[model samples]
Target: MVSGKRIADVGYKLFSGSMMLLTVYGGYLCVLRAQRYMQKQKQLQLAAQNESTASETIKD
Candidate 1:
């Protein structure tokens, strides 16, 4: 039969491992979201620049 202390140790290890996995997964999601946000910002800046250039050409 398994001892109580061994069972407790196994349970603690499993819980810690699961928590670590969840933390890593959460961090990955955050990085992906940040990347998407940066891309969107870059696209917006490019579009604004293009619009300004187009207007200037029209005026000239």
Candidate 2:
């Protein structure tokens, strides 16, 4: 039969491991969101530049 202390230790380790995994997963999601936001900002800037150039050409 397993001792109570050993059982408690195993339970604690499992909980800690799961929490670590969740933290890592959360960080990965955060990085992906930031990357997407940066990409969107770049596209918006490019679109704005294109529009301005188009307008200038029309004026000319």
Candidate 3:
């Protein structure tokens, strides 16, 4: 049989550990999303540049 104090201690440890893991996972997801957003922005800028250049060429 476990004592009340031991049970409480174990419960607290489990809760805290799970919370830490969740925080780390959330941070990782945020980083991945940020990277994807940056990549998309870069692609959009390149496309715009290409379009401008193509138009300029036609005008020449």
Candidate 4:
């Protein structure tokens, strides 16, 4: 027969484990978003550079 204390301990462990999993998952999502943001910024910078070069040629 399981005692109430044992049941409570099991519940606590399960809750803590789930929280840890969520924290890791959240970190993963953050990393993915940051990577996407960085990539987009890089693309924008390249586009601006190209545009400036194109304008310079037009002016020449």
Candidate 5:
């Protein structure tokens, strides 16, 4: 029969490794999605500003 200590140690290592991998992958995906969203937002903001500027210029 295996000792309780050995089982606990193995479980700890397994959980720790899985958690580390999950965190790394999660962080990478978050960064990728955030960048895409920010880029889209920036494009929308610039387009709106340009439209406003164009309207003002036409009135002058």
Candidate 6:
């Protein structure tokens, strides 16, 4: 009976550790996604600025 309890405890600990690892990995992915999003936004803003400048030059 005691041996069975010990096995159960070990299994639970392993499962908990795996879950924590997965959570950390998920957080890392989210940071990468946010960085990509910010980079894309910056590129779009720069493109718009360039377009406006070109239009102004053409008008002048």
- Count of steric clashes across candidates, in order: 0, 0, 0, 0, 0, 0
lDDT of 2 by residue, 1-60 (tens): 999999999999999999999999999999999999999999999999999999999999
- Model 4 Cα lDDT, one tens digit per residue, 1-60: 999999999999999999999999999999999999999999999999999999999999
Model 1: residues >4 Å from true position, as ranges?
A: none
lDDT of 5 at 3: 100
Model 6: which residue pairs collide? none
TM-score of 5: 0.70
Q: Local error of candidate 3 at 10, Å?
A: 0.4
Q: What lDDT does model 2 reach? A: 1.00
Judge candidate 6 against the unseen true structure and give its global Cα lDDT, from 0 to 1: 0.99
Candidate 3 lDDT over residue span 1-60, tens digit each: 999999999999999999999999999999999999999999999999999999999999
State in Å the error of residue 39, model 3.
0.3
Check candidate 3 and list the clashing pairs. Answer: none
What shift in Å separates residue 57 of candidate 4 from its native position after superposition?
0.7
> 3 or 6, which is superior by TM-score?
3
Model 4, backbone clash pairs (residues 3+ apart or across chains), number? 0
lDDT of 5 by residue, 1-60 (tens): 999999999999999999999999999999999999999999999999999999999999
What C-alpha lDDT, on a 0 to 100 scale, does residue 47 get in candidate 1?
100
lDDT of 1 by residue, 13-56 (tens): 99999999999999999999999999999999999999999999
Give candidate 3 misplaced runs (Cα > 4 Å): none
- The regions of model 4 sitting more than 4 angstroms off are none
Better of 1 and 2 by TM-score: 2
What lDDT would each prediction earn against the true structure? 1.00, 1.00, 1.00, 1.00, 1.00, 0.99
Candidate 6 lDDT over residue span 10-48, tens digit each: 999999999999999999999999999999999999999
Estimate the TM-score for candidate 1: 0.94
